[model samples]
Each structure stands twice: as C-alpha cells, then as structure tokens.
Target: MERPSSNGDCYLSLHNFKQGGLVYRDYLFTKDSLMVFNSFGDGPISQSTGAREYYFFPRKNVIPQFSWNSSDRRLEVTATDGNVVFFDYETTAMTAASNLLAK
Candidate 1:
C-alpha cells in the first residue's frame, strides 16, 4: 500500500511501516505466470515465504485456459498437459454459513 524506499523505488513496502518479515504474491499476468517477493529488513526472510515459481507453455498448439463455472461457483483451469484443476469458492452469505460448522 505504501513505498518505504529511500530513493522511492521499492513499491512493495508500507510508507511508515517497517516490516521485517517475508512477503510474496502470485498472480496471473500477461505471461503464463509471474510472481515476485521482496524483503527489506532483517535477514533474507523472503526465502521463507516460498520458492519462486515460473511456468511457460509453448503457445503453438497448446492453449491453457481458465473459465468460471458460475452454477458450481468454481473456477476451472485447463493446463497444457491436459490436466484440469477446479477451485471452488464459497459464495453464500454470512448468515447462510458454510459446510464447515463449529463443534
């Protein structure tokens, strides 16, 4: 939300917040996959977040795509290897609750 760098280059850190832990994020960019994380203070804690990942598929014949199944409240992804992955989301209201109930 803020930039705490001296030269105003680091766009990840907070303005006045001095965070000394790991931070990372992953999102689908224009490329196949792109993610970045940076650690400003303390030792190299960024590595603790997770290992960096990169995925690139040949755009010749394989077309990896994603679609949202609104009826099932899921986002399905078809990979280049013909593998399929579905991410189901909870769209119910707070009062409606979810399958996870308290003991």
Candidate 2:
C-alpha cells in the first residue's frame, strides 16, 4: 500500500511465509531506509483457537537503494545485504468522488 503523508509518500509491504508455522513480515519503506517488523508464534497454543501467541520483533532499519525505470512501470531495489528485488507496478486513477473527498 502507498499513501501520501506530511513528510513524503509512504509505502508499506506485508509478506507471509511458513517456517515451522506461519510468519509475517511487515516492511515500511521510507526515504532513507526500509524498516522491518517481524511477527511469529512464540507462546503456548490457545485452547479455543489452537493458535500460538504472536510475538512481534523490534523494528530494524535496512538500507536499500531504489531505482525506478524510465517508464515508471518497473522498480529495482538493491538491499545492503546484496539482495536485489524487482517489482512491476502501476498507478491507480482516483475517481472524481475520491478526489473531492481527498481535497
């Protein structure tokens, strides 16, 4: 998700993966670096839901270099750990009603 903010535009990405169980990673992309928060099961399972309690890890800053394509349709991100990720993206047009509401 992308949204306008007072400082600048903010981007958020959430990813889920399976280790022994389900784990969630939340990333907040900022101007200088990307902040990451991780959450996973830790405690004992619940009697009703049969799910373990969730433990959220502290946020960490991961520096990444961002490059946008000339057409603005593709984005290339290089992380400090020498990992590269490419994303294909597009913009959404706001409806007239939404634009008015935003104003």
lDDT winner among the candidates? 2
Specify the poorest-scoring 10-residue window by lDDT in model 1: 92-101
User: Could you tell me every candidate's TM-score relative to the true structure?
Assistant: 0.36, 0.32
- Reference-based lDDT, each prediction: 0.37, 0.41
Residue-by-residue lDDT tens digits, candidate 1, 1-50: 22334654322111113322443232232224323333334455543444
Clashing residue pairs in candidate 2, if any?
none
- Please provide, for model 2 over 1-103, each residue's C-alpha lDDT reduced to its tens digit, 9 standing for 90 to 100: 4454576655434233332453444455443444555455555434212322221223223444556666856555543433444555332111111111111
Q: Give me candidate 2's TM-score against the actual structure.
A: 0.32
Model 1 residue 40 lDDT?
A: 38
**Which pairs clash inside model 1?**
none
